[model samples]
Target: MTTDCSSVAYFSMEIALDPALPTYSGGLGVLAGDMLRAAADLGVSMVGIALVQRKGYFDQHLDDLGNQSESPTAWEPEKVVEPMLPVVTVRIEGRDVRVRAWRFLIKGLGGHVVPVYLLDTALPENSPWEQKLTDSLYGGDAHYRLCQEMVLGLGGVAILPELGHSLISSYHMNEGHSALLTLGLLEERLEGRALSSATEEDIHAIRAKCVFTTHTPVPAGQDQFPHDLVSRVLGEERTAALEVTGACPAGSLNMTYLALFGSRYINGVAMQHGEVSRGMFPNYPIRAITNGVHAVTWMSPAFGDLFDRHIPEWRHDNLYLRYAIGIGTSEIREAHVQAKRRMVAELKQRTGVQLDEKVLTIGFARRAATYKRADLIFRNLDRLRWIATHCGPIQIVFGGKAHPSDVGGKDLIRRIFESAAALKDVIKVVYIENYDWRVAPLLYAGADLWLNTPQRPQEASGTSGMKAALNGVPSFSVMDGWWVEGCLEGITGWAIGHGPESPDDEVFEIAALYDKLEMIILPMFYGRPTAYAEVMRSAIAINGSFFNTQRMLSQYLANAYFRPAVA
Candidate 1:
C-alpha cells in the first residue's frame, strides 16, 4: 500500500494469473505470471502491472475439418479481484483517456503475498471507443494497438505512484509492449528541463533504475511503429527525443530497441536466444537467463504426494527433487499410474474417447503457429503408422489456439485434423479444443512422452516441457531453446535432431524421429517398462529439480534486480 512496501515494479501487456481469468493467450503472459508467483514465494519486494483484458484473448473452436474460429472469452473479474481507487490518464488521439486498475493477490507456498495490478480503460468517464481499448488482448488495428500500448506503458507508470510505489528501485519491462514506460521514466528525469537540454547523466540516471527482458527472436514477436504513426500517437516531442536517443535506429519506433537503449540490464529469455539477440543488436551487451516453470504448480497431485512422502523438503526447496533419485522406481511407477488413470478418465469424459493408461501416449500442445510445425509428425504418416503398428500402439493428443489474424496457423490446425483422419485406421488421434491452464497438467502428468518441434532459433524458451518433466514425463524434442540445456540424450529425454538450427531437412528429421520411436523409445516403453520408468524418474530428478521458477527468480534477484550500479 506504500512506496517502501514494493521496491520493484514489473510491467507487461498481459499476465496469466488464472485459467478462469483468460487474460492470456499463450506462453508470454503465462511466463509473466510465473515470475510473479515465484517472486511471492521468495518474498521479493515486487509489484506487477498488466492490462485487464475485459473480453480475454479468445475462446477457441475447431470444426470437424479443423477450421478454427474464435469468440470472446467472457468472465466476471469482480468475482476474483478488487478494484483500486487510483485513476490515471494518458494522451490518446490527443484526448485524455482515463485508466483504472483491479488488484489480484497471489499467495505463495510460504504464505507470503504479492499484489498484481491489471490496468483497465473501461471507465464510465472515458468515451465508448476509449472504454474498449483494453477490452481485448492483442486486438484491433495499428491505431488501436498503439493506443492500447499507451494505456499499458504510460498509464501504468502514472498509476504506480498513485498506488504508492514511488520508492520503486527498479522498473522491469517484461517485453517490448511495455517499452514506452521508458519514455515515462524519461519525463520524470527531465523534470522541467527540455528534452534537448537533458544531459548524458540524465539518461544514464534513468537507465540505472531499469531492467528489461526480450522474449523471442521472431519478428512478429517484436513491436515496431512507423515514424508517421508514432508522431500521431506519441506526438512530435517524444518522437524527437526517441530519434535523438538512437531508439528509433530503423526509422521506426522499435519497442525492443527502445527498452534496450533505456535499460542498464537487458537479457534474452534463453541462452541461445541471448546469442541470437546479441547478433540482432551487435552493439548491445545482452545476457542470457534461461526460462523455467513453477515446479509446485506443474507437479501432478500424485507426484506431489509421492514427493511429500519421500522428500518432504521439496515443497520448500525444489532442489530437494534431486533426492528423487533415491525414491523407489516402483513408487515412481505407481504414482505415474495414479496420475495417468485420472488423465485417461478425463479424456473419456470430455471427448468421449476412451484412453488406456497402459497405452503409449504422445502429446504436442502449443499455439498452432506454422513455424511450430504442429503437423510435423504427420509429415510422413506411413513411417508413423509402421512404427505404431509394428513396435507399439500409440495415441497422440493435440491442443492450442491460433492468433485471430494468422491464416497459416489456422490452416495448421486443419492440417492436423486431416492427418488424424488419414491415420485413424492405425493411430488414434484427438485434438482438444480451447486448451488452457486448467488442461495443461492433465496431459503433462498422463502422457507417456511430451513432444516439441519448433523451427530452430525461433523458440526463445519452452516452459511446457519443463512442466512435463515435473510430472515425470520426458521430452522428445529438437535441440533448441531451453531443450539444449535440458536434454541429456535418453537420460532426461530424447532429441529429435542432432544439431542446433539444423537445416530444414524435414525428411531427415522425420526419419530420425520415427527411427528413435520404432527402435528405442517404443521398445523400451512397451517391452522394458522398468528401464523406461528410470527415464521418467531421471526427468523428475535432473530436469524437474533444476528447471523451475524458484531457480529462475534467484537468477533475476542476484543478476538483474539488485545488480551493483556501475561507477
Candidate 2:
C-alpha cells in the first residue's frame, strides 16, 4: 500500500541523514534523519523542517595542552556540506527570514515525495549573533538556545503558509523543540476571534492534525522555562494565543507539556519509555511508537547486496535483517577488529597515546551528561587497576561533547579526562575530542563492546548500541532504553541495572555489576571465542529484525497514520 497524503511536515532540532552533516549531536538527531530517509523510501509523503545553522554545531579542537576548545563556527558556502536547492523567503516575527530549504526527489522509494526544508537564520540582514545561530548543532547560552527553538517552532509554523503550501495533512513534532509550531497554528486559527469564542473543540481540531513524539524520558531534556520568562522571550499575547499552561513553577510552561496538551497524538521512543512517559505525563494519555533506523542508508551496501541474494524472506519482511544477513559471520567479525585497531591507531596519532592491542577494548561514547554515568568504569579505581594490571588489561576509548554552556557536563568531561591520564597504559583511557555524527559511525563500527552505564530510565532509545550491534560489536548496557528490547540473556549483551529505577540499596548495583564484569565478563570475552561469536550473531539477528527503521515506519503507518486515516 502506498500513501498519497498531500504533505506531512516533520520538525526537529537536528538531522543525521549523512555523517558529513555535523548538524547532529546524538541519537535524537540521528533518529530524525532516519525518519526522513525512511519516509522517502516508503513514499510516505513528508517534508522535514530543520534549522540551517551557520556553524552547524561545534567544531571540536584539542589545544596543545589537550584541553577541548570550542568557539563560534562560521560555515563557508562551499563547505556547507549539502547539495543546493532554490531557497524560499518567509516572514517570521516581522522579519523577512531567508531559509534554504531542499526538495529531495528520491527514486524507487514509491510515492512519498520527501522534501527537507532547512531554515537559515544566517542571511546578510540577520544580526551577527543571529547569523551565528546556525553555527553549531547545539549552540550557546540558555537565551540563545531558547531563541533558536523559538525560530524552529514559531517561525517554522509561519514557513508553510508563507510558502503557499496550505494542504498540510499532518504535522509531526519529532520532539519538544517543535511544540511551538502547534502554538503558532493555534494563533493562526484565532487571528480575529475573541478568547470567549475559542472552545476546546477548536483546540482539538488544531491538534487533531498534529502528532508529537518524545525521545527522552529525562525531565531536564524535556524543556521547562519560567512561564513569565518564556513570555518575556515570546510576547504575552502570543503566549496566550497558544494556550500554554501557566500553572507551571514560576509560571513556566514545559515544552513537552505543551506538546502533550497541544497534539492529538503523542508517543514515546520505546515500549518501556512509553510506560514511563505515561506516568511522567500523568494528566495526559501518552503512548509508545518505538523508534527505528533505515537499513539501506545505514547498512553496508555489500551487506544489502548479500541480503537481496540470500535472505529473500527477510529482505521484504525485515529490512534490517535483510541487510545484516549480507554480512558473513567471518566478514563481520574481521571488520569489527580492523575498525577497532584503526580507531585505536587514530586515537594514538591524534592524542599521542599508545597501548597494546591485546587489552580488552571497551567503548563509551555519548553526551557528557551526568545521568549517562560516563564515568562508571572509574567507580572503583583499585578494582579497575587489578582487572587491568592482574587480569587481562582493559582499555577504554571515550568520546563525547557537552553543550558549550553546560558547565556541569563540561566539568564531568574534565574529571573523566584526569582519570584517563591517571590510568595511562594498563587501563588506558583516550577520549576522541569533538563528538558529532561523523564520529558516531566510527565509534559504533569500531568498538569491540559498547558500554552504556546511564542511570536507569534516563536514556530514552539509545540507538548507538544498535549501530554497534550492526557491526558485530557486543553491548554492555543498563537495563533501559532500546537495550531492554534488544538484549537476549547472555547472548546479545550484558545488563547492569535490574530495571528503570536504581533504588538506594542498588545505588552501587551498576558498580557491582562492573566489578563482576571485570572478573567474569572480561574473561568470558577472551576465553570463549565461539560463544562471543554466537552472542554477536544473535544480537544482529534479533535487533536486525526488531529495531529497524522500516519496521518502525510500517507500524507507524498501520497504527498511527493509516489507522487514523481509515477511522
- Candidate 2 per-residue C-alpha lDDT over 1-567 given as tens digits, one digit per residue, 9 for 90 to 100: 112334677889987656665556677888888877777776676777787665766766665334667865454544543444434443334445555443333332555456665666676767676665556666566666667777787677766655545677678898888787876677668886754466887788777878888887878776766555566676656667544343244466677877877777778888889988988878766778777766555554333455566565553356446345445666556655666676667777766877556656788888887788788778677777777776576778888877766777777787787787777755777788777665566666666788988777778888778777765677888888888788776778887757555453245664666665766677777887656766666767777667777788777666655445321
Best by lDDT: 1
**Global Cα lDDT for candidate 1:** 0.87
Worst 10 residues of 1 by lDDT: 498-507
- List the lowest-lDDT window of 10 residues for candidate 2: 100-109
Models 1 onward score TM values of 0.98, 0.87
Q: Model 1: how far is 373 from its true place, Å?
A: 0.7
Candidate 1: tens digits of C-alpha lDDT, residues 432-531: 8998888888998989899998888788888899999998899999878899899999899899877775566666777888889999999999899888
Work out how many backbone clashes candidate 2 has: 16
